[model samples]
Target chain A: MKILFPIILYLVVSLLLLAPCALCQDEVSGCVNCHSELDDGDIEAPTELFKNDIHNQAALGCVGCHGGDPTSDDEDLAMSEATGFIGVPDPTDIPKICSKCHSDPVFMKSFDPGLAIDQYAKYMTSIHGIRNSAGDTKVAQCASCHRAHDIRKANDPKSSTYAFNLPGTCAACHANNVYMAGYDIATDQHTDYERSVHGIALLEKRDIGAPACNDCHGNHGAVPPEVGSIDKVCGLCHANNMTNFDQSTHNEYFDALEMPACETCHSNHYVDSPSTDILDGETSVCAQCHNSDESPEGLEAADGMRKSIDSLNTSLTVVKEKLDESDRKGLFVTNALFTWQEARQKEFAAKTAVHTFDLGKVTGVTAEGLELASQADVAADDLLAGYVFRRAGLAVSVFFLGLLALLLWLKARQIDARQQSL
Target chain B: MIDRRSFLDWLLGGTVFAGLAAILYPAARYLEPQEIPEAAISSLKVGTIEDFPLDSGTIFKFGRKPGLLIHDADGKFRAFHATCTHLSCVVQYRKDMGAIYCACHNGRFDINGKNISGPPPRPLEEFDVHLKGNEVYVSLRG
Candidate 1:
């Protein structure tokens, strides 16, 4: 009874677990499943290959496509010689398998169909598809980046080909320098990208738009660009700026000197906020190229502007100290009222120093120094008023105490006089 | 008759007394050690127990601070300040190693808020938690 009972339980569990997939496998059970019995057809395209495919893992079986009595285990009943069981799909019909979901507008809407269109069209043009069309079957397909069963949103950090992870995905193939070297391909793109501004910004700041290797090179049908066409790639966004840069004397000078082009100032990867000081005088980026002695005027202007800024900063420190002192002495109301006035003056002074070369702005700048002095006078007046209020309270309290003491002394004298009279 | 001289003396004495009182009041305030106010505690909600998974550390946001909610394998739930006391970077839960790690300076904290490694001078701040029905509550004071 124990042995029989164990066998009965095992059968019940197995039947329950396998029921769903077993039902699915009855119909459209492909040629590969029955291939051993059949005398017709090549055997190389193994059913084992489809085990890793998305449909198989999802438990959708061969009956979904080939169509027949999936319930019937008998070969003759399941495989009708005429109309029952169909064979494997042709290479041409591979698109139909993909299009089942891809062609459905509603199903593909969540993924943004425009992206799929571009991806599919680009893939067809890619070397993989071209070779596959010519009957070379080992190239990558749609399921490569978007995994078979584990497909997910691009924004998900865990997604295999997410923006942050794309480099690592491409590096799987491209970073193998030796393997790719045979194909005349260099994998140094990853190393160079890591050092570029785009790479640093993407890694450090997590900027999504910062271009990686796939942004510049095609993910599927990538090719190297001509040396003359380098500027065109850069000119996509920096067209007007590059045009002016091309006309500038620096471009030709760099060409002659064998120095770096516009990228020397702007940088190629991970470009940052440009320093305004760079434009103010020849001391910044220009100094990198031109000798400091050659441009005396530019160098002098930069130094003068710096000194003015420093002087204004020093003045601001003095004004802040006095205001703070006033607040500490219970002159809060007065300081609060006009302190911003003095503070604004200091701010304007700083602005003037920063833009000293602009004479028109500096003329209006002296008003801040005068305004600061006037506001300090107002705060001093407010402090004097508070002192008077404090003094008044003290005077009244002291007067009352003194008057009471004098009254007590007089009453004591009266008492002594009365006692003497008695 | 109250003479001008006497009146002036009285006024001067009153001013001195008032000035002294004004100075002393603020001085007393400065001398007193600030007691943590009860009003500050009332506003803090460490979050309910259901919000935290019993087997993992869930991050809870309280005011400007982040708190960690950890559920042990034995089904016990605990919450600690996510801030590293050393430099204030948010500490992360390392599920595999069963420890909390600070990325900025590598400060490490054990499950009980004890500073286990790196330069942290103190343990993480722990809040008292209670479960009522399905909801969990955290208090500012343990």
Candidate 2:
């Protein structure tokens, strides 16, 4: 009996020593069991919330985050401070809590090879992080946007930081006048964005190609786009427009006057679709800055550009209508249509050249368009004239054929009368 | 003496012959292809060295097809058929990209006539360039 007792006691002690390590490898842990069975709402809420968390899906238990004896059923042993049990981290410490695994390159690679580990580093440079580090608890923490227990990948549609959802996530704080009052920032950015062309494209049309909040401000290191860099931010999508603007004479002028390039006329948050109306007239963008009394040459150039574009557009429309008429009359109008297409391309080129802010360049392209339009018009007119000539020739040929038939009949009658007289 | 029946038979035969000749003459003329005068020179003179700016390309007519003449940044003249090998869309020299680009399908080719990107399945057809006394001439490759 004594020998058996000693062997059994040694086995029990060894199993007890190795129990926590084994539980860590298992799918379930004692921490979840205790917390789930607790009647207190505070303790039970975390267990329920943790069930849907990404960590939970990865088989990470409460012990993975809180640090405790996950193998122990005893409350005293499970919550013991010696086992590194940190019940709840402070708001300021939440970023560090998330960054523990996120910042470790080796650890993060095991989860996602392509996922960047620079979020924590970038977050440090953000206004929120700077303020949070300064002991301001009101500012956004990692949990505020990502949600503490149920964090998801940014690409996930349900994620708060998804491209389509980011604007709303940011507006939650930014749009609230009370929240922004302390920061002395405009709270109507969201309202203004909802009405802008980009916002309508994203929110109303549901176009994934459209820009959202983070597309310009950046997500991790969010900041208002600087005046000097705003053109580049917009250029990410409007490459051709940006290229044209960069090469324009206004580039140097805007830089010298410390004016934002695109926003000077287009506005910042409420950029509308461009129209030719912005090129001339009393309400023209140029007239807003340059009046005939002050800048006669600039006004004349603007007027000339507007008139040239208008003339090309009018000529193109007239030629297209004529071609369509000829086509409807069963005439071969393919050649005329091809010429019209060339004119249309020239007109588009002329519009693009307007960004050059050079009247000669605009007029040069418009001249080509006008010439093409005239050629197409002449081609259609020729086809219609050919149709008229064909009808007249057919009528003349029918009259001559009738006359020939009558003459043959008369000759036959003469021969028959001669035979009768014989 | 010529009888009336014999005279009538001769007149009917002549009328049929005239009608047949009138129809056949027009038909023959319509079927015949119109002759266009061909230029005697196999090679086309594009321009002088002063006419073509350095590091730029100019499109000129080579018989029926469009030819591209490029004066590369190194001051060497190179010529290629402007039509893309994929869909025969004319390619333009993009100074920004430093490559020949077809706006049709976004096909691109290097200055050396190498197909680089997009839908172009073959390099641009290169032409032989002849330089004489500051004048540039281009001919189809043998």
DockQ of each: 0.02, 0.06
Task: Please report how far candidate 1 places residue A12 from its true position, in Å.
Answer: 27
* Chain B fold agreement for model 1, TM-score: 0.64
**Could you give the CAPRI-style class of model 2?**
incorrect
Q: Report per-candidate TM-score of chain A alone.
A: 0.41, 0.73
Candidate 1 lDDT tens digits, A230-341: 3445544334344544665545666676655545555543355433455445546546654567766545554554455444445555555655665566454333334444
**lDDT minimum window of 10 residues, candidate 2 chain B:** B33-42
lDDT of 1 by residue, B1-142 (tens): 8875466556656655655665575577668884333335433454565666656887765443567778876788777878778656567677775888765445678888888865466899987777777676666663
Candidate achieving the largest TM-score: 2
Cα-based lDDT at residue A73, candidate 2: 67
lDDT of 1 at A373: 50
